[model samples]
Target: MPVAVGPYGQAQPGCFDRVKMGFMMGFAVGMAAGAMFGTFSCLRIGMRGRELMGGVGKTMMQSGGTFGTFMSIGMGIRC
Candidate 1:
């Protein structure tokens, strides 16, 4: 019997792997966008010093988590 192999002659990635990859990609993109928007908004609102850092960090995490969750779900569905 013949065995199935991926393009590189390796086993194909499983569903979980695909989902994980999707999440990481989404998280990176979301974090970058969040940082940019958060910085601008915080500065506009007169946030300074630690306050600005905290606000930007919070926004980044929230956006990253939201995007990761959705991307993982979408990847899982495709598998």
Candidate 2:
């Protein structure tokens, strides 16, 4: 018979890790996209989506406290 885990005592992180990770990823992507939109509107008036997405890449570099809050909420639900 197959066991749920191998020789290691610890099991792989499952639902909660996935939930928190997904939420954090989405939030970060959204924040960057929002910044990209603002850039497209203000500085790059004639520029389009591809150019705007470059700004998004740059914008996502910073880690603000926003994702932390969402992660905490997910953890709270898990507990």
TM-score of each: 0.91, 0.39
- Kindly list the per-residue Cα lDDT of model 2 for residues 5-67, writing each as its tens digit: 746777656666767775776577656656765575535566557876665555544322355
Off by over 4 Å in 1: 1-4
Question: Global CA lDDT of candidate 1, please?
Answer: 0.92
Give one digit per residue, the lDDT tens place, for model 1 in 1-79.
4545888889877878999999999999889989999999999999999999999999999989898889989999999
lDDT, model 2, position 48: 59
Best by TM-score: 1
Q: Give the TM-score (vs. native) of candidate 1.
A: 0.91
As a whole number from 0 to 100, the lDDT of residue 54 in candidate 2 is 67
lDDT of 2: 0.59
**Which 10 residues in a row give candidate 1 its minimum summed lDDT?**
1-10
How far is 46's C-alpha from truth in model 1 (Å)? Answer: 0.4
